[model samples]
Structures are given as C-alpha cells and as structure tokens.
Target: MERVGLYPGTFDPVTMGHLDIIGRGMKLVDRLIIGVAVSEAKRPLFLLEERIEMMKEECGKLEGPGRAKVEVLPFDTLLMHFAESVGANVIVRGLRAVSDFEYEFQMTAMNEALNREIETVFLMADVRHQAVASRLVKEIARFGGDITSFVTPTVKERLLEKYRK
Candidate 1:
C-alpha cells in the first residue's frame, strides 16, 4: 500500500521554511499533500489559489522515494476529514518553537480523536526559518521591510503587491 502524508498549514504566502519542511518530509514519506487551510480567524496575505500557485511554482513539482507523489490542495473543512479523503495515514507539521509545539500538540490530540487511523508527525523548522513567521513577516513588510530572505521571491513580490494595494 502507498503511504501518504499530509502537510497542512496556513501558508498565506509560501515561505522557504514551509518548503524546507515539505522537501524534507518528501524524503521520509511516500507521498506528500500540501494542504492550505482556508482560515477566517486571521487576515491572510494571499488567497488559497494564489498560495497554491505560488507553492507549485516555487516547488516546481514533487518527487518522492519510490513512486511517491506531491500535490497541493485547498481545504476548508476539518483537516482530519481531508486527510481521510486523501488516504493519508500521517500528517506532517513544522514546529518552530514551544508555542508552535503547544498548538500542534492540541491539534494532534484533537485529530487523533477525530481519526484513529491518522497520526500527526512534527518536523522542526530549519534554524533559518525558526525565527520567520507569517505574523512577523507581515508586520515587517507592512512597514516596508525586506522579506526576500525570509520567503520565496513570489511571496516577496506578493507581499509588496499587497502593501501597495
């Protein structure tokens, strides 16, 4: 049977950090599905379609061990439900700090309750991206700060575009 993994995130804009986790996770799992959660709680820098396009453009395509495949999806309902629909048994998450860990822990527990067959796996963010976050990145760019080093060129351009608008 094929092993499918889900990487769910609020990737308002695709960041190098997010890519880092996806790249690394691709190696470990047979397939990775990058799921962008449509959230209404926090203001986003980009829409789901834009974020998916940017991620696809940046990643170029997904290759995995054996016959693994990578795909991008926009999810609006319970993530566990999405995981089930994708036939994924594991969920990959990128943890940058204790705060992230706490939040992920709760999510994992909740997901576990929701789906017994699915398991949540956490991957620590690369040190370079450990300090970069959507909130801070948005704040910096809102004031005209450079974020090219933090996110992908597409993301930087999109941020600037939003700033201008």
Candidate 2:
C-alpha cells in the first residue's frame, strides 16, 4: 500500500511557503498530489488553469524521495473525494499562524468524519516565509508594492501583467 498525500489549496499564486510545505510533505509520502481547488468564493487572482500551470512549473523543479512522484491536479469537488480519487491516505495542510488553526481544525475534523481512513497532517510554515500568502501578495501587488519576494518569478510576472491591464 503506497502512502500517498493530498495537499489541497486555492493557490492563486503559489508562494514560497506553499513550496516549503510541498517539499516537506513529499518526504513523508510515496506520492504527493498538489490539488488546486476551484474556489469561486475566494475570487482568486489567477484563474484555475493559470494557477495549475504555475504550480506545475514550480512542482516540476522539486526532486522528492526515491520513487516519490509529485503531481499537480485540479479539483472542484469535496476534498475527500479528491483524496480518494488520488489514492491519498493523508491530507497535508500548512499552518502559518494561530488564526488558521480554527478553520483547519474544523476541516480536519469534518474530513475525519467523512473518511476515518484518511488522516490530516499539518506543517508549520518556515518562520521566514510565515507571512507570505496569496491574498496578501495580491493586495500588495494591487498597490504596486514589491512582491518579488512573495511569489516565484513566473507568478510575479503574471501578477504584474494582470494588474497592469
């Protein structure tokens, strides 16, 4: 039985913190699936396809543990459904602050209720990258603040282009 992990998020613009979690999570699973959620409520800066492409580009650069494959997939349904479809036994989530806990905790509990076989694992963001988030990046970029440090070069370029239009 392979230990596959599912990491789901509405990565409007994949940040360093996200990559950090992905890198660490990949070490613990035989396969890691980065699930890009089509969250209409979030009003993400990047479209689903753009977000998927950005994540794919970044994930492609990662080299995980032996025989550990990384895949970027798009999902619009419940997370548990996505996890089961991907054969994931674990769900990976990143926590940057205490405020994020309540929501994540609730979600984890709900996921457990949905599928007791799947476990949710949380990773604390690296201290230096703790403040990086897609929403904040978009807000800053909207006002022309320096976001080069928050996102990848590809993402930064896309943000700039989007804002410039």
Candidate 3:
C-alpha cells in the first residue's frame, strides 16, 4: 500500500517554515499532497490562485530523486474528508510552540473522532523557523521590514507585490 500524506494549510504566502515541514514530511510518505485551504475567514492577502501558484513554485524546488511526489491542490471542506478524498494515510502538521500544540491537539482529537483511520503527524519546525508565521511575515513586510529570511525570494517578491498594490 502506498503511503500518502496530506499537509493542509491556508499557505497565504507559503513561508520557509511551511516548506521545511513539507520537505521533511516527504521523507515519511510515498506521496505528499499539499492541501491549500480556501480560508476566507482568514481573509488571506493572496488570492486562492496566487497562493496555489506560490506553493507550486516553491514546492517545485523540492522535487527530485528519492523524495515523495508532491501535489498542490485547493480544499475548503472538512480536513478529514479532504484527507480521505486524497487517499492519505496520514495528515502532517507543523508544531512551532506550545500554543500550536494546544490548538493542534484539539484538532487531532476532533479529527480522530471523525476518522481514526488517518493519523496526524506533527513535525517540529526547524529552530531557525520556529518563530516564523505567515501572519507575522505579512506584518513585517507591511512595515517594510526584511522578510527575506522568512520566505524564499520568489515568495518575498510576490508578497511585496501584493503590498505594493
């Protein structure tokens, strides 16, 4: 049985921290599906298409031999439903702090109740990226602070472009 994993997030800008989780998540599954959430509630800076394109561009750099095949898609339904729809054996999540764990823990419990077949795996963010979050990244960029360290050049350019408009 091929092991497919789902990593679901809004990915408003697809930061380096997100890429870190994705790159590491690939090692644990045969295929990785990056489910970009259509989180209208978050009022994302980038449109759904723009977010998908950014994820594709950054994820393209991670593709190569010995790594899981990566696919990016948009989803706006229950997470477990999306995972099942994609035939995922696990749902990968990133943990950067205790607060993240608290929220994820509740989510995992709810998801487990919904469907115990798919497990949730949490990957700790790299120390350098532990403090990085899409919301914070946008704030820094909005104030003209350097965000080159939080995201890739392509993402940084896209983010700046958004603010310029």
Candidate 4:
C-alpha cells in the first residue's frame, strides 16, 4: 500500500524550519500533504489563502526524484479527520524542544485515542532551525530585525510586505 503522511500546521508564514521537517518527512512516505490549518484562534498574520500559496511556492522547490509527491491544502476540522481524508498512514511533526514535546505528547495521546491506525512521527528540527518559530519570526520582522535566516527570500519579502501595510 502507498504510504501517505500528513504534516499539519497553521503555517502563517512557512519558515525554513517547517521546510526542513517537510524535506525530511518526504523521505519517509510515498506522498506528503502539508495541511495548512485554518486557525482563526492564532490570529495569523497571513490569510489562509496567502499561507497556502506561500507553502505551495516553497514546496514546489522541493520537488525532485526519489521524493514523495507534495500537496498543500487547507483544513479546519479535527487533525485525525484531515489525515484520514488524505489517506495518511503517518502524521509528521517537528520537535524543537522539550516544551514542544510536552504538548505534542499530549496531542499524540489524544490522537491515538481518536484513531490508532495512523501513527505520529516526530523529527527533531535541525540545530540551526531550533530557534526558529513562526511567532518569533513575525515578532522579529515586526521590529525590523533580519529574518532572512529564518525564512526563504520570498517568505521574508511577504512578511516585510505585511509589516509595511
């Protein structure tokens, strides 16, 4: 059977750290779905459409041989439901620190209770990207700090454009 994996996040502005998880996640599955959550509660800086477009643009560059096919889509329902909808055999998550593990651990337990058919896989963020987070990236950009290292040039440009408005 084809192995499909789901990586769900708000992806307010897709960062290099996110791309790192995606790049590595691609190696583990036949297809990878980057689910951009419609998280109104997060008060995302970028609109859902904008986030999807950004993910698509960045993910496009990841396409190559021996890699899983990538798809970027929006979701607002329960994560397991989304995973099932995409036929995901695994749900990939990126871990940056112990704090993240605490929350993810709880989430994994809950998700496991909801559906044990799909497994959750966590990938440690690259050391260089350990300090990167979308919230922090936006904070830096808002203060005119250099965010080139945290995100791609296109994403940096988009963030700056949002701040300019």
What lDDT score is found at residue 165 in candidate 2?
94
Candidate 4, lDDT over the whole model: 0.97
Q: What's model 2's TM-score?
A: 0.96
TM-score of 1: 0.92
Whole-model Cα lDDT of every candidate shown, in order: 0.84, 0.91, 0.96, 0.97
- Cα deviation of 164, candidate 3, in Å: 1.0
Can you write out model 1's per-residue Cα lDDT over 56-154, one digit (the tens) per residue?
Answer: 776665463453478888888899999999899999999999988888888888999998898888889999999888888888899998898888776
Predicted model with the maximum lDDT: 4
**Residue pairs clashing, model 4:** none
Candidate 3's residue-wise lDDT over 66-152, tens digit each? 899999999999999999999998999999999999999999999999999999999999999999999999999999999999999
Any runs in candidate 1 off by more than 4 Å, and if so which? 61-68
lDDT of 2 by residue, 63-159 (tens): 7446358999999999999999989999999999999999999999999999999999999999989999889999999999999888889888998
- Sort all candidates by TM-score, best to worst: 4, 3, 2, 1
Residue 58 lDDT, candidate 4, scale 0-100: 98
- Of candidates 4 and 1, the better by lDDT: 4
| Candidate ordering by lDDT (highest first) | 4, 3, 2, 1
Estimate the TM-score of every prediction.
Answer: 0.92, 0.96, 0.99, 0.99
